[model samples]
Target: MEELLEKLLQAVEFGKVDFKSPYPPQLKGENGAYELTIKALESGVGPQQILENALVPAMDRVGKKFSENKIFVPQMLMSAKAMGASMLQLKPFFTSGEIKTKGTFIIGTVKGDLHDIGKNLVAMMVEGAGWTVIDLGVDVPSARYIEAVNNNPGAIVALSALLTTTMVNMGEIVSDIKANLPTTKVFIGGAPVNNDYCQKIGADFYAPDPQGVVEHLSKLAS
Candidate 1:
């Protein structure tokens, strides 16, 4: 059982989605995350164990590697794709209440920003950490964020901005959400954002990378 779990984690960490995937030439024709996860479930491995031992650790390694510049966007995307394949098998458990999520996260690219790669990366990392992510997509307005919070009380909000010009919208969105939902924790990040700007905008947290966001969400969950 432990060996199977380890193999599943390796597949995810190396971005092996299934036996048909050929990106990692060394893992050619091997049973990837898709197959291993199903096998683990069929062999009586609990869904929680698959998530805690296999999925979470795999994504954590990917996040750390990304932070260290050991992997780039393409690799990260492939890893996310692998994780998504595993997640499909786990979704039934989640829907059936056999597995529990840590919390709800409402994430979006602030208004005037159309970039989604950064926001999507953060959303994927946060979701990999065991939270429910509500991605509002790009060009989301402040009111939309407020409405999402209103709908999902106690949810954390994360705003993303990729351009210097669009970053200004982050402040407005933060203030609006805070004004309406004073207890909501707002985290901000993007290429042009920094801790100083985060503080100036009155956001609760600022992450330079997806790992930072994962750490923040994990701490919040605990």
Candidate 2:
């Protein structure tokens, strides 16, 4: 069981999507995350074990590598894809309440900002870290964010903004959520926003990278 889980972790860490994927030459012709996950389940490995033992750990390594600049966005994206393939197989267990996530995360790009790449990466990384992500997509308004927080009590909120012009919207959204929910923790990030802006806007946290967000969430979960 340990060996199988280790292989699954390696597959995801190395960005191997399946037996046919060839991006990482060393892992060619090997069964990847998708196949290995299904195999683990068929062999009666508990879904929670697979999540806590393999997938979460693999993504944690990927996040650290990214933070250290040992890997960049492309590599990180591939690793996320590999993790996503495994997630597809495990999603049913999550839905059936057999595999519990750490918590719910609500994320979106603030109003008037059509950019989604940053938002998407954060969502994927957070989900890989074992949080249930509720992505509201780009150009999301304050009302929408407030509604999502209302629907999902205790959810951590994350706001993204790529354009300076749209950053003001982030402040407004943060204010709206805090004013309405009062208890929901809000995290903010983007190229134009910094820790100062996060503090100025009354957000709970600010992460410069996706890994920062993941690490903070891990601390909260622990």
Candidate 3:
């Protein structure tokens, strides 16, 4: 059972979705994260184990690799895809309360940004690390973020922005979230986003990559 969990972690870290997935040529024709996750559950391995032991650590490693410039967006995206494939089998458990997540994460790109790739990657990373991710999609306005925070009380809100011009929207969104839900934490990311801007906007956290965000959320959970 431990070996199966190790294999699942390898599959996710290397971006192997399943037997049919060919992104990583060396891993072709082998059982992927998706299959191993189901198999572990069938073998009576707890869903939380699959998440905490396999998926969480796998994504954390990938995120560090990305932060260090050892991997690029394509590799990171593949890892996220693999994680998502496995997540499909576990979603029902999470909804049923059979498997508990660390916490809820709400994410989206700020209005006028219209970019989703970065936001999507963070959502996947957070979800892979056993958080319930609610992606509000691209071009999200301040009002929309406030509404989401109200509905998900205590949820951490993450905002993304790719364009220099659109990054300004994050300040307004952060302000609105704090105004409507003072206790909610707001995390910010994107190509143009920086810690300086995060401090300027009064956001709680600023992660340059998905891994840092994962670590922050994990700390909150712990």
Candidate 4:
């Protein structure tokens, strides 16, 4: 059991999507995350066990590597893709209530920010860490963010803005969420957003990178 889970973990960390994917020359022709995860489930391993023991730990390594500059966005995105392939097999368990997630994370690019690459990366990384992600896409308004938080109680909100101009929208969203959904935690991120900007807007957290976001959410989970 441990050996199989380790395969899944390595597959995720190394960006191995499946047997046919050949991007990682060293892992060529090996069963990737998708096949390995399916095998684990078919062998009677618990889905939650696979997630907690395999997927989360693998992403933790990826996150740490990213934070340390050992890897960049492309590598992290590939890892996220590999993790997502495994998640495809595990998702049904979540829907059936056979497994549970850490929590729901609502994320989006604040209004006037059409750039979704950063937001999407954060969404995928956070989702691979076992949270249910609700992506509101680009150019999302404050009203829409409030609606999502209102509908999903206890869900944490993350606001992203790639441009200095759109950054004002993040503050607006944070303000609206804090004013209306007082209990919900609001996290802000972007190139133009710093801890000072986060504090000024009354946001709960400020993570400069995807790993920091994952770490912050991990604390909330505990």
Error of 1 at 188 (Å): 0.6
Across 102-221, the per-residue lDDT of candidate 1 in tens digits comes to: 889999998988999988989988887778899999999999999998999999999999999999998888888888899999999999999999999999999998899999788878
Question: Which regions of candidate 3 deviate over 4 angstroms?
Answer: none
Ranked by lDDT from best down, the candidates are 2, 1, 4, 3
Q: Tell me the spans in candidate 4 whose CA falls farther than 4 Å from its real position.
A: none
- Per-residue lDDT value at 180 in model 3: 78
Against the unseen true structure, what C-alpha lDDT does each candidate score? 0.91, 0.92, 0.89, 0.91
| Residue 221, model 4, lDDT | 99
Per-residue lDDT tens digits for candidate 3, residues 1-222, read 999999999999999999899879989889998899889999999988888899989988988888899998789888888988888999898889888888889999999988998788889778877788899999999988888878888889999999999999899999888887888999999999899999999999999888789888888999
TM-score of predicted model 2?
A: 0.96
Q: After superposition, how far is residue 194 of candidate 4 from its true place, in Å?
A: 1.4
Candidate closest to the true structure, highest lDDT = 2
TM-score of each: 0.95, 0.96, 0.91, 0.95
Error at 112, model 3, angstroms: 2.1
Candidate 4 lDDT, tens digit per residue, 1-222? Answer: 899999999999989999999867889989999999999998999999999999989988988888898987788888888998998998899899999999999999999989988889899889878899999999999899899988889999999998999998887888888889899999999999999999998999999888889988999999
